[model samples]
Target: MNNMSVELNYGYNGAIQPYNKQFKSNFSGFNHFEVGIRYMFSEHLGAKIIYKSDKFVNDPGGNIGIQYNSLGAGVVYNIGKKIGLTYLTRDNLGLLFHLEGSVGFANSLIQQYESEKTKIIGIGITPQYRINNKIAITTDFTYNINLKQLYGFDGFPINTTKISETGSFYNLSIGLIYYIGENKYHSDWY
Candidate 1:
């Protein structure tokens, strides 16, 4: 059986703030979009790989916006059937909850001067309502940490630069999930 799904997510992404003044500045009002593929191994366990794009501006009414791209893999823990819960609003309508953790890389542009790349770690909670056996609506809230290190300057009189820090961001997403299997989960014997 094909226990797979594809999803598209859209939501708000927090601004990227630099740790030091020597680095680039901060910007707000960012937007996010993501696409992913999920493989469900069981009724309560799944894995997902996703790619996300974030749009941000330098200042208010800025002409051009920077695009940040991130790719990650996460584990999903399903909690609907485990708690003996099923439909919520109507017949064939089911409510489900999931917890997820992920790790990946984020590539960002810090103006035309230099590029910034960071390792990202995130945790999220998703609540979904199944519209039918093949489709569902889901919303997720994820918190992400960006980790990077800056090296010291190469050579000078007595000059050196040292940089190593972690930044953070949060995302709230709403999306549709489409299933590609006859059942939500596969049998152990299969």
Candidate 2:
């Protein structure tokens, strides 16, 4: 199989404490989305180019919303193969682990708040079920921390979020990955 793949995901996203007051819920519905390309150099090591977005809103009538968009580069590893799970891969199951760094902007979706530039760090794991040689289904959970964020989740100026003026958020997503190649099994399975 070849080494290229693309993924699309969408699900729930939320802002965590130190960035927001304890008054808002983190679950912002199905507004979180991600699309990315992946390439494996070997069965165990790889890299990804990603664009992800998350929208956050306060409770009904709360009149607050924020959106964050990011572009990331990350190192990925196939954990399924390393732990003697090649059998699972043969049976159409897989797992990946990643750590990424990103640069992006956050803005208030419905207010005059200015867009703020920020940097972020994230770690995640994805579990996959291959539906066929060319397609697979995956679920991912990622925890990310924002660095150099200048405002709080409420779109207000904040002195600092935490250490180094940072805030945190997370995403839980489901997606599809399409493999491009001419074999019955991609490197993830073969």
Model 2, span 70-145: residue lDDT tens = 9999999999888857684475788999999999788865576678889989999999898988999999999999
| Model 2: worst 10 consecutive residues (lDDT sum) | 155-164
Question: Judged by lDDT, which candidate is best?
Answer: 2
List model 1 lDDT by residue over 46-125, tens digit each: 78888887665445554333455777787876655455444233323333343343443332233333344556777787
Task: Evaluate model 1: give its lDDT.
Answer: 0.58
Give the C-alpha lDDT of model 2. Answer: 0.82
TM-score of 2: 0.90
lDDT (Cα atoms) of all candidates against the true structure? 0.58, 0.82
By TM-score, the best candidate is 2
Clashing pairs in model 2, backbone N/Cα/C closer than 3 A:
none
